[model samples]
Target: MSDSMVPRKPPSKGFAKKKKNIILLSMLAPGAIWLILLRYLPMFGIVIAFQKFTIYTKNPTLLNNIIHSDWVGFKNFGFLFTTSDSWKMIRNTVGYNALWIVLGTVIAVSFAIMLSLLTKKFVAKAYQTLMFFPYFLSWVVASYFLMAFLDPTYGLINHLQKQWGIEATQWYFVSKPWPILLTVAYLWKNIGYSTVLYLAAITGIDTSQYEAASIDGANKKQQIRYITIPHLKTMIIILFIMSVGRIVNSDFGLFYQVPQNNGPLFPATQVLDTYVYRAFMATNNPGMSTAASLLQNVVGFFCVITANSIVRRIDEESSLF
Candidate 1:
């Protein structure tokens, strides 16, 4: 065939560029609007942190609040830094989040591996559906479920204890055992979602690798160690990096609700979020809440950056940024 007879047409570069821009804009508009409305707009309220904000003040105006309100430069932050509970809040937030990261990864990765091994399609689907059902339930609802099991006077544990002729323990008021309980609770409530993610990652992996490993005399555990773990490394690092950002942030609902906000457990369970809530309620101090929120955001931002840096040093390709 003659080259001229092929009738090749030149690509419309400008048209393609315009089409690409239009598609990009269309895809981004909704998220951009949502971020502006939900995330950025409320950031204006952060001024309340630097000001002595009194909700009951008669003059109901942002300008008045900014002007008349005393400018306590870094005083609120000072309180966060210097207060006795400050260290505790920091410790609890970081501690729990760190625990969550480790335990969550272990359970999720392990469960995903087991889930990947299941050959029965129907059973796998059913099991995954069952495991994922709890993710749909709100933390508030889950809190009630937790209370039913852990309630001091009349709870599932107490009832079971009675049946076994043993004394029921007051779990709510008990703080010493809370770290373990909270960790397990966090894992139980959250692992399914992570497991699903990891399972998806596992499924994305080529099966030929497993078959090849088997032919090479790699046992199940060895196959997993050599191929599966190596393949999942990227996903794990990505997840770990993402989790580090929230290291300074606690699950408000999980800590607040599951514990039923029992005062006695405050020492053990009082995270930055719950502490902020209490401070907000006691004095109705918007400043404290704002300060806490700002601190969390700042700390989270720094933590993510630091984590990404670490990840980059270890594996540049897997680093989020």
Candidate 2:
């Protein structure tokens, strides 16, 4: 047909809207599917926490198996609380995380501020690279690195002590110093990542704020107090809230591998995760293990909610929700 001989048709609004909706849905599909598969689907296993689950089930379906399993009300949870080590583990977990949150925030923010103050980009990059290197190392590898310095007989610290005519101390068997050692190790591994996060936030701050402060005759510390810190407040609060959520969780490797699972160090190093792992391994009790995990998750959920609520009351815009 010749041009203009045929009637021109307009685009349908309904089809256009449908096409746009399809594109939006397509963009959201992967994340939605991932959430369903990894998060929502696994939640079904929470029932196992309340059930006396067995491996010898004849049922082919998971739901059927759960239906057949004996339901024990809160016995599994009660078992965890009745143990002598329960309070100890809970104390260690919360204590270590509390210290970590405080120290990590301070150190990360300080390092980030230092990084922001650097005029030489290359020097700053080098320092940042060095700081971040330890974070990439696995806990197993980090443990060995620690052992090299801490091992009593032929370790570097012992060798140095020998040269200095001081007695070599057995580190792994000693519980007294482990709290400090573990805290240091945790800080060494985590500070880099935290610094990176804070640095990004700092970098996002308006340079004009600092310039204005400088024009007002503010010194470096004054500029930091008046301008930098106020800008970082939101990021700080968000990070703090997230950390609070994981108060019940601990670095299994840090508590386990780094200490080499030494019985003597259990007093200082045995956090909730490590305790649960050892208990589950020794007893082969899925119900107890699942119950422990469920408790941790529930506590963590409430912690996040509580932290967010507090922040919302103080500054609604800064709250995660």
Q: What root-mean-square deviation over C-alphas does model 2 reach?
A: 1.9
Best by lDDT: 2
Q: Candidate 2 at 95: error in angstroms?
A: 0.4
lDDT of 1 by residue, 1-321 (tens): 988789877879998999999999999999999999999998888888887775437876876676677778777766667768878788898988988899899989999999888899998898788888888887899888877888867788888998999988989878888888888777777889999999999999899999998998999999889988898999999899889888888889888988888888877898988888887888787887898889888988998899999889988998888
CA lDDT, every model vs. true structure: 0.86, 0.92
Write down the RMSD of all candidates, one decimal each. 4.0, 1.9
Judging by TM-score against the true structure, name the best candidate. Answer: 2
* Model 2 steric clash pairs: none
Q: What is the per-residue lDDT of model 2 for residues 122-149, given as tens digits with 9 covering 90 to 100?
A: 9999999999999999999999999999
